[model samples]
Target chain A: MSVSALSRPSFSRRALLILLSVLLIALVVGMEQLAPLFRALFPDQDPAMYERESFLNLTLAHLALVLVSSLISVSVGVAAGLFVTRPAGREFEPLVSTLAAIGQTFPPAAVLAIVVPVAGFGFIPTLVALVLYGLLPVVQNTVAGLGTVPSQTLEAARGNGMSAWQILWRIELPLAMRVIIAGVRVSVIINIGTATIGSTVGAKTLGTPIIAGLVGNNLPYVIQGAILVGLLAIVTDLAFERLERRFSFGESGAMA
Target chain B: MSASHNPTRDTASARLVANRVLVTLLCAGLLAAWLLPFATMSPNRLASGQTVGLSEALSAWQAIALLALSAVLAVAALRRPLPRELAHGVVLLASLGLLLITLYSLGDYAQRTLVEKSPSARVSQGSAFWVMAFCCALAAIDAFQRASSGWLLRLGYMLIAGGSVAMLFASGHFDDLSIMREYANIRDNFSDQFITHLVLVGSALGPALLIGVPLGLLAHRHVRLQGTLFSVLNFFQTIPSIALFALLVAPLSALGNAFPLLGEWGIKGIGAAPAIIALVMYALLPVVRNTYAGLKGVPPATVEAARGMGMTARQVLWRVEIPLALPVMLSGLRIVTVQAIGLTVVAALIGAGGLGAFIFQGLGQYAIDLVLLGAIPTIVLAVIADFTLQMLVVLSKPAGTRR
Candidate 1:
């Protein structure tokens, strides 16, 4: 709460990361006013855009799709990983892994093809495909993270008379938390990229501009979409990195 | 370990239950195949039409043959203390045979029914047949995984299976299936798409390595630069392939215009230039990250020792560092290659002419088989690239590090 604390190295770094991201978003949303400059760059082509959706709206929609699907996938993936690692669920480990692998091998495009017919187009199919695509990394990392928790630590906890649930909640998961977060980080970043494909099925993401540009051969629309999505990804990634650093530093400090 | 795995304890009681379970699954799969539709007789590719069950689609003998194979697999499963290798072998044969038979019958059924219908009428393999084939393939892959075969052997099995299917094509068996019909329609364009897809992948990889390796070296040699470089590369990577393709269009077109020679070299806003450029951008993160990691993994003691031995820095890098780093770098390359193959499909959306052309065309027409024609090949390409590169990684690993 102190001004001195705010001046600390980590706090300043965190502030910088957030500030940069906000500025990037502001630039992207204001890109329409910069159309003249863009037109100057690509002088041979018409500067007009056919993209009906504004950059801001598409960016928000893309983020919403990513947020929803990522939440669902993380829960499902983490839960599945936790279950398989449990003594009672050990037998299903291979089954869980195999299913996740199968989910991944089927491409998002193919997933779209299959889902669109059954679920129809727009948000639902896109969400379904994103969830499927995102599930594998989260599950893989969760399982790997939990599995790699030093058995000696668990044994010590058990010796202290902690119940299995208490051991998992207070001990195992805390220690495995960083790795699990890394998994979620990878999954979310991947979803951010994959979610653009949603525009193909009319879910209205940043891909709207890209696809529209491709169709119209309007180069600037494509540039605007690409810049926004790219910046969003960078911001999200930087935010995750900052969080990871804080966790590692705080956890180590606590342990020491 | 040997003493604990007593012959009866390992096999007798649990094996009996497992065998019964396996047999039941096989029987159930067989029942589904027989009772459900094997092919659909559509008036056209877009129209949903009548479903033809296995018996109606295949000649009686062929239908009986499929039934017999599943039954035989069930009976084989019933054998106690079955050799693991034998179980895998039987599953492999049965599944491969099932796939071949289904493809043959698909063509045959189409020829029989569609010959009497309008020329535009299409006959495609239906849901039941796909389910049946998937069941068989899953069973086969499961058994293969359990069998613990070498990677080379597994790849060999795949080649043999694919070759047999190719032989069927040569023998004119698949000429009537709707997928084949589509292939025949676009046979000329198919090769061009295939070549473009390969070129896109190769072009992306070539520049990625050139740029990524040095960037990785720079990141490695300098600590402060690592995060900035990686975050930038990572940001580019996280942008969707479609978005990346879009992002490149304006700048590249501008660059091409500013320098007319660039335009002459075919560096316009859209097409191969943008697609390849986007792919290369995507390709950079993995290659750079891996190269850095690989170089970092070179033991500091080894470097120190090399320097102590009067070796120049360059000599140490080439002789000690690179040799040690080769395997990890190859593994990184493997990831990039697989990722690029999949991403290249998206590039096709930008008139770059890859498998995505068929996928988009199929999407526009709502033709599932046409989409599969594109989707399946892309998946195959990715899988093959993944597997082959994985093998190279394993082979390239230093002997001491071999697992």
Candidate 2:
């Protein structure tokens, strides 16, 4: 309980960033070196397919989808979580929980099929499904986080004459921020992984090359898709580690 | 007056009555709405534009009977503190009933000659049916556990309620199985491929449990290693499965190619083994994180007492720490497995034989039916795995879990 790491120098964060950037650089270098070999091997396939086309488009699309949907999902999930968790709105809690749980329990690919006719294929539907599938962790975490917020802190907020809204925005959210962040981190990571499936349905993302390569049995193309994805995931994860540190309490330092 | 503490007997009674009524109404409303498409006087004739034929009526009746049986089981759940064996029996019967209903419903839907015109009987065999049934089962389980009577009996009530919904659909499908010759999915000779899917899933669990459990245990014991272990594993998990599948291809293939002997035994570096290895990597974070968190969560005094009694470090961990951490580790395993099953689709890219092949196969061929054949089984396996793990988690909980 006494493990306050706040007094630590900020330089460690710079160190972390450098460490992560170097990792990224290394991957890029590796890819650059392999480019010639890959081209030599796949003269028949489009040369730029590995370079400017699949890898970059996939990573960007993945980042964009995850970034937008995570923001929307977390905002809505946290808000709904706050609303439904109140004593007066308690009964709705079960319904929300059920919906959230079910949303995740079903396969997103199957869900994509169901959503396709309704939402159409490609970006929006896949994005929407990702948002829905990603909603549970943040919302559940919010509910549980707020639930576990110290009673004394809540009482202090009330004693200070903060309105319910203020208490939530100021006292509760901040205290629960770490937990909520943990939830968001989980959602973000899962979304990164799940985003690959978007290609199977033709979103023009990185998964397309992977899926296409799989079907065609092209090893270099497959490696091109996979390496980029794995690299992006690692990079994005490192970014989150930094973000979590800046906003969260003392535990952020411990988190990485 | 503090409302939670307004302990007057009359107040408790009134509250109980109100709750019971609400539960009943909500349960009925949801269940009925879910089944509404099935309950028509005339059956839906998707193929012929005809009303439900008489034969369809018979299946519908059986569905209704099955539903009633489920409801009756829920009612019986009102009976208190069910005997240990009886509780197990009810769970089994309800499960059996649900299975029977699905088999029957599948039969009816699959059978072109079955003369069933009602979509209700057939609908329960699909996605909506699964969703509705799962919801009902949850509600029943909640109500049963929370019932004013014994905990076991309350749980039984819930099981019965859920079981009935599942049965209605299952039996509805099963009875019509004989008629379903035309729409049969794949000539999936269940001998090898089925075993392959199971094996892939099973093997993924191998490295997962092996790597995850030790890391979990080690991270739990060593404070210094915790952050590094957690971050590394978390980073490992953050990589999307699709990417991981693709990423491992060349290196593994290169290794296999470099070493001639490795390539022959299905170890030619790139496909199945790499897929399994990557799947294991994907599954590791949850196990380790949960195990670490679970172990760290052990009461400080408990560990202190174990040490005071001159217990060796090994003794303390094996005897005290693990028993307590079992639930968390098991849950972690569950998450890993469900995740592995779903993510296994990525393996298809590498010729790691799996159901994903059909899904991707369908995608390429533009065959919707083939996609469903692959996707449906994966979903079912995920759900089934989730529930089985849930049962394990519930059963393994330390107190008030003997039921």
Per TM-score, the best of the predicted structures is: 1
In model 1, which regions exceed 4 Å deviation? A1-13, A24-51, A54-56, A88-107, A113-120, A246-256, B1-16, B19-37, B71-81, B304-311, B400-403
Interface RMSD of each: 5.8, 4.5
**Candidate 1 docking band:** acceptable
Question: Which window of 10 residues has the lowest lDDT sum in candidate 2 chain A?
Answer: A1-10
Model 1, B1-403: lDDT tens per residue? 2321342234454456444334545665677786777777878767878887776778988878887787657655654555756876887788788777877777777778877999888887776776777677666666666667777778798899889888988987777777888888888898889888889999999999999999988888987686568756866777767877876776787789789999999998778999988889888988998899999999999999999999998999899998888888998898888788888888887889888888877777777777778888888787778768878887888766653
**lDDT tens digits by residue: candidate 2, B27-144:** 6534643553321221221221222322353367666755775664454344354543455355445534544453444444445443544433232233334433454455444333
**What's each prediction's clash count?**
0, 31
The candidate scoring highest on DockQ is 2
**What does candidate 1's lDDT look like per residue over A73-189, in tens digits?**
999999989987875455356656776665565556666656665466789988988888888888987888888788788778877988888988998787777778888888888
Could you give the DockQ of candidate 2? 0.40
DockQ of every model listed?
0.34, 0.40
Among residues 3 or more apart in sequence or in different chains, the pairs in candidate 1 whose N, CA or C atoms overlap within 3 Å are none
Error of 1 at A58 (Å): 3.0
Q: Candidate 2: what's its TM-score on chain B?
A: 0.67
